[model samples]
Target: MQETLFCLRVGHRLPYSMSYSNTTDFTNPSTFILLGIPGLEAAHVWLSIPFCTMYVAAVLGNFTILFIVKREPRLHAPMYYFICMLAITDLVLSTSMLPKMLSIFWFNSREIDFSACLTQMYFIHCFSVMESGILVAMAFDRYIAICDPLKHSTTLANPMVAKIGLAVVLRSAMLILPYPLLTRQWPYCKSNIIPDTHCMHIAVVKLACADTRISSYYGLFVLFCVKGLDMFFVALSYTQILRAIFRLPTKDARLKTFGTCSSHLFSILAFFIPALFSSLTYRFGQNVPLHFRVLIGNVNLLVPPMLNPITYGVRTKQIRDRLHQLFSHKDI
Candidate 1:
């Protein structure tokens, strides 16, 4: 009991603890403490309601979309397949973010082992970039479907969709694998109290005693290559899509064409807007309240997954028809 007490107290101090701090070189720390949204400790119970709601909705929403798409013959198109990939990414993202966060908010269970923390960071980042890639692919799908409607089937055939899916997965895994490994190589000496809800790459990297410039720069490089390139292509594709939409002779044709993109546009905005905002806030909003920063940081993870499926089900006619057939005991 005494030994356990000693370890807990020491582990709470992390690499800064006396025994661990004596040497600059270190193997691993006892544990990392995740501070769940600073200044919200008193309201953790109340805050967990929304977190739990979002988590459940995210899981259900994504899985429902996946099931409907997979089971229905009408949804076998490349667009739906890309959406399935997105559903999978949403599953991973919500799984990566919510479990530990809920545990912290509900049970005050904050301590995480070193290997687990690294693993969590790996999945979180990998899925995030993969989702970004899928969004870009979705944009291309929209562009082809709208601008080159006659060639849509040929352009995004099953083989092409499979290749894109494989590429997205491989790219994400390759880019994000180094992040956890980099953090693993660096020794933590200051503290292990990560002032965030989950094991984020930046949060963990910032705790290392070693020079983090390489890791930081490498992160930024990956960020620009994956998300930056994705956004650029998406913007370009939409530019072409808009150009095609306006060229249509009838006003009804323009509205019909524009309506087809509403779901994807909503999805892009939901995922990217909060994500970029939170990242900027994290980097530059030093004066911002920690709780506020934490909330914004988490918004993208929760909101997009819950909303994306609902948006598509409501906006896209094929999905809506398929869903209605599924629930109403009719054929799609």
Candidate 2:
């Protein structure tokens, strides 16, 4: 008993704690301490300002998109349905981490229970995957709209979009289900201090006292297979879309048609660029600063949710008109 207590106390300070033995069961930690951002703890308070701003914007913007879509009868269409799904995905993704991040930064409440940490990790990745899938679905919507205009309504009906949204949700959940289960089996004999804002699969798995090759390889597989395939489809769809757009005889016609896709394209960039950058930084950026990597990871979730609604609001004619009418003290 005394030895167990000694080990537990020492585990809090050291990165690698007592080695796992065949006879011992070392599964869960009571609580994991989030260090916010290692090597930049002094700046956490100031850093909370931008983080807080992004969270607030994400909440309001996504909620506004949902509200506008729900209330406006004319806005009920396949495209808007997809946008609503994306909004919900973004809200969950950002909400999973940002509030806890703010707590860590502002109030210094950094301890996350094991189950809660796993839940956060699952929600973050699951919704992230859902967002990527939704983006691909949006790309396909754009493809059918531009490439096969006559068949667009028939081919991508509201029912079909709803089905696609369901598929996205199911696929995301199933893919991420293994993450927490695998993490739970691992023995976390290392220090409980997570040097980032929230629990990530790789971050948590790395603390395991046992071999984590399975977890690492599985994470990479999901990243490359699921997200990679989603990216490929988006690219292919856009390729066909651009081809169709350029085929329009008049310049004005082509520009007008292409303008419809501008928001989705920006949203794709906003989501994937930072996600890829952060993933690469985490995996291969050994020389990169830890704080920068954590910040980039946070930005990956934060910026997209905050930007998506704004992008769609300003770009979509129906949405823009409704917003102006709703907020201009005019009858919506």
Best model number under TM-score: 2
**Cα lDDT computed for each candidate against the true fold:** 0.83, 0.88
**For each predicted model, how many residue pairs clash, with residues at least 3 apart or on different chains?**
0, 0
Question: Candidate 2, residues 211-296: lDDT per residue as tens digits?
Answer: 99998998999889989999999999999999999999999999999999999999999998899888878888999987789989
TM-score per candidate, chains pooled: 0.91, 0.93
In the range 128-246, model 1's lDDT, one tens digit per residue, is 89999999999999999998889999888999999999999999999999998889888886666677888888778887888999888888787777788888999999999999999
Q: Which window of 10 residues has the lowest lDDT sum in candidate 1? A: 10-19
Candidate 2 displacement at residue 158 in angstroms: 1.7
After TM-score superposition, the amount by which residue 254's alpha carbon in candidate 2 deviates from its true location, in angstroms, is: 0.9
